[model samples]
Target: MGLGLFRMFNCFSSKPREIPIILGSETPPRPKQRQRKEELGGGGESKIGGILGRPYVDINTMYEMKKELGRGQSGVTYLCIERSTGREYACKTIARGKLVRKEEIEDVRREIMILQHLSGQPNIVEFRGAYEDRQNVHVVMELCSGGELFDRIIDKGTYSEREAARLMRQIVTVVHVCHFMGVIHRDLKPENFLLASKGSLAPLKATDFGVSVFIEQESQSHMNPIHRRRRQTEANKACQHTVQQNQRRPRRKALTDINELYRLERELGRGQFGVTYLCTEKATGRQYACKSIARRKVTRKNEMDDVKREIMILQHLTGQPNIVEFKGAYEDRQHVHLVMELCRGGELFDRIIARGSYSEREAASICRQIVNVVHVCHFMGVMHRDLKPENFLLVSRDHNAPLKATDFGLSVFIEEDKVYKEIVGSAYYVAPEVLKRNYGKEIDVWSAGVILYILLSGVPPFWGETEKQIFDAILEGKLDLESAPWPSISAAAKDLIRKMLAYEPKKRITASAALEHPWMKEGGEASDKPIDNAVLSRMKQFRAMNKMKKLALKVIAQNLSEEEIKGLKQMFNNMDTDRSGTITFEELKSGLSRLGSKLSETEIRQLMDAADVDKNGTIDYYEFITATMHRHKLEKEENLYKAFQYFDKDSSGYITRDELRHALTEYQMGDEATIDEVIDDVDTDKDGKINYEEFVAMMRKGTLDNEGVIGKERTR
Candidate 1:
């Protein structure tokens, strides 16, 4: 045995007296020539020392045990505070009664030995000491407050490929280091890996070694108390046999013509580079979705790589519980046809919208499936950078149909130690770290978190009028957990959301950890209580309302009493900042931040543009007041009549197309196309003109306004 082997068995016998373990500087005495055989071969009982057979030492005399932190299958972990230094640590108490078999007792000794051997290494939790008494065995170690890997996985949002790969790299490092140090960790999983602290970029620490063993012990059957040598050999042989069988199996040749196997039907959907069509297999009549990528559209080399990578990833991820099954891939002169499972249940949001009265439980169920996709993808060594509601589909029209993830166009293989900088993903679902260009797989969790927020509240947590505004909101806006529906939402749900949406990638919850969250877990803390109807209204459409409704709201805002508009006026004055009687771009940004606003700078600019009725670059008091007025205020009968009068210039009880055009042109809010769209959206009776009732209904009811409505009033 070398110096490393000596360091592993430094513990002394408990026969005489217990010796203190000095972590940093302890060096065992060198073995004499005569005693070297006994130490290296390890045949006698003294060879193992007092690993579990230690004389009773009262652990309570040194450490004060507090509340129970967690309970596992083997032991209960408590928050242990050292009496002398008042330093906190975790104490796992394993009852002596549980060690019924001799093998169990020996395994415990090996675990303690391995932990001591691997101590002082980065990413492995620091072991303080192990103590034994008559009733139980106590193991003390570093307190990891950042929570479990599985906890954050289901708890939070989506992740980018780079972020997921970063997390995976950390996990792989722990395994690599363990193997290098002559120990094999048999129980390495997400739950075993924990963050050292609660900080975003906290180091991941391997906290368990119960089933770990030294390589020498595994190789030598006589030295191994469990006699695992034969078992290990059999396992290796079985793996090799499986590999040989797979190699001997006949492989299918690539199909050049998809038309020969399947008959293409109606087009299901179309994208920028490809078209998805419903196809029927000629032999079996099984329906599948065939996505044909036009070769011409993939002009760039990177774009072509993206297409090929997507096909490969889909094939690689086939048979996953939450991923769509890839049927086959075909190539022709014109296009590349990739076939997969056809999900008849449609998109995730579509099901939610159709459900009518949604609840936290249902949202949790959906989010669990979404995060599972992230977990599965990351585990398979693929990073799905683009994760949004549209990418998910239900397997069938059944109410309890299983959800599946589709589309891998932006996905990539997780390369070790690689720093990914390319910005990818939908604007609303992208993580902040992706924007910073140093992200990892955690970006998927962040995106999933955004989807959760939308699922719970019926709209995205970060709302904006444009892509730039959405990115700004992602970078700067605070997550809103106090708005309308949020007050009624469960605390557990909000806590998970906070962990998922953590600003730092290192701090953000992993997909496996998120899945273990209380709210995200199956039949866990998520409530069955119906969410507010307002959330459903907002989710249906987040864009600007019709131009007519906006003009009406503004008219109503102008007529408000002094008391009603007092707060609005003060807010406008405060935003003006320099007492300039108008709010400039810089002033508006600063003011919003001061007011605890979640709006980004770009969103503020959109608000400023919407409020500035005179088309000025800044927002004046009147414009600000009008733009900030709540929708309920526009519902008052007097206010509605006044606004209708403003548009119904002729007082003929109906506003004709000319009147609408004139009002819109006077405000410079629309042209021919906008006027037509507004009429097309708000004109319920199809009279091509608006009546008083119609105007009031437009003001009161929720409308999917696609054009020219002012900001804040339409979105918030």
Candidate 2:
């Protein structure tokens, strides 16, 4: 439905249990005699051997159950520690005995299929492996320790239109990729989106597509609701049929995953990456592209690691067509052989230039194809840091041929809260932030804007006799909308360009937002109407104010005295039924009733909706503090001091370094050294401990510098 421009690799994908090394070829296994069908998933009294590629082992031998991660109507997810490796994974235990309906079984199968297919995708939370017990099915997956996305947005001082655009772009791109894979995510609300980890600009991930479809069974018009409904019914029926049809399984020897069946045909291309050769499978005589990279040619360890990572990324994206399909990989003493789908047609620009005098409609059409590939890449958490036209290839010489993105040599998987400072990308398309040594995926959007501008006008947006002048113009961001043909360009098109070219990285429109612009919707056609001037003015004002308000909230939240937040946390814990450290609405109701106050379900929902800043369905300490601070009744300063005395343990009205250290670390405030530093800064008498008067003075921080209270000031 939209076009995508990249900000970076967009390659940050997820976990796997036994990630098969794609290289080092193995001989094809001899065919084994097929066994007679038995029962569901080879079921005969549920004697487990193996179903998927993984071997069945004692589940208890592998993982040590830590604590509950989450609970739903059908299952409970535990934070498990792998006994031998000490690696953490999420293990979902779904009680089979609790399920009665055939639909429920089908649901389990559906979830398994979705996780299996989308396992290694970046934006989607990963599926490691699954095991079956006597009474339940246990599915293991990557445990995302990062908090939810909307929660960060609420608490970040650096929030802006650009920030919102970046996050939404991730969401939309993920949805876009899911659609391409024939999986329609039925539930995509804020609750389903999480940051891969904490801090700012973490990789946003999609999870819990509970009502999602793995594959569509019928074609229908997306614009028509009736046809869509009919398609839905067909898809559901197909899913049920698939589950019933696979009820019985036949045993057979597992074949080796190898590309030894293929024979080299001819050399296609050669570059710094590797030598590409045309190859064909001997059994089926199907064509393929094989990349042979000599190990000796790679001088650095990191470069060789990059080569290995590329193969892994390719294997993970095996079935997606937008990405070049990975067939297999093999390793010899001298080189690595990576096989893939061959694109006969050349670069996208090669066709665009050859066609000549193309209309705006054609430009939009071509741009849409590029967007689709980029959308998938971003959703997979891969940033194609380099996104010029040369990186994309047409499937064939045909005019209507689709394009696929390639050359992931520059791609890298980003983690949640990580910011890349590398200077990468072609000179013309690089974003301003990149030059400053601080940037994110937004670099791709800037590059895409350059592409779109050139596609529309057949000339570069900013140009000069030398590279320096060109870069200067880019940094200045002055576009000549009135220059020659631009005067005749559609206002919607011009408006989009202006938004994209905004000087401030914090204000630039995201690729997703750009796709939704009227110019994009019109397919490059001129719009008689422009965005309402007053509305536009109001939008500008709102964007500015929204940025400030979010930043202010973040500062206030961060600067809040730990004592104040601690009080709210106690109240939060009282309502936390499972002692999970977060309180859901049901728990809140029960907890509040126990405390002699009863609230209706509607009222409870309303409060949770307001207080659950992260939209993670539960309220943590931060959210609890944020919510309770605005309550009508306030805790007296004397009460806060008394609470401090309680932590003192000796009723001495003072806290030793060890006592304060234990308190702060337990509350997730800071480390031991940080707690010591904070106490020393507020000790007032050069003592090794913090007294009540000094603590109270530190809490009332309006009179002192930041060092007096928290040792350092928080800033965006």
- TM-score for each of the candidates: 0.46, 0.40
What tens digits encode model 1's per-residue C-alpha lDDT throughout 1-716?
Answer: 11111121112111111111111111111111122211000111111112243223456866899999999776899999977568899999988788775456555655665665565455888776676666778888899988997676566576679867878888887787676655667777788888877786777889988767655432443334245433443212211212133233221212256676679999886544567899997746889999887877555444454565565567555555688977666667788787789999987766766676888998898899898889766665456887887689999999999899987767765543545666657667889877666766778889899889887787778766434556678889589999878899999999999998998887888888888999989989999988887776566554224456667767887788887776777777777778988887678778867866555433454455555665545667666766666556657899889989999899999988898889998876665655755665566799988888888877777543233221111110
Poorest stretch of ten by lDDT in candidate 1: 39-48
- How much lDDT does each candidate structure score? 0.66, 0.55
Residue 194 shift from truth in candidate 1, angstroms: 48
Candidate 2, residue 707: lDDT? 11
- The lowest-lDDT stretch of 10 consecutive residues in candidate 2 is 707-716
Model 1 scores a TM of 0.46
Candidate 2 per-residue C-alpha lDDT over 1-716 given as tens digits, one digit per residue, 9 for 90 to 100 = 00011111122111111111112211111112234321211112213222211112245655788889889998898999766458788888888776666556545655655665554444888665566555677777778888677677777756779878888888997787576555777667898887888755578878776567644444543433223333334434333422233232211111222344467878776543357789987645778888877666554344454565565456443434456766655555566777778988876755664453455556666665565555444444445676666567787888788777766655554333445665555555667776555666556667777777766665557664223455566777777778656766677667877776676766776655666666665445634432223322222221122221222232344446666465655676677869887886668768756755444433343355445543445667656665566321222464445446645877777788787666554443444434544654567697888787776555443221111100000000
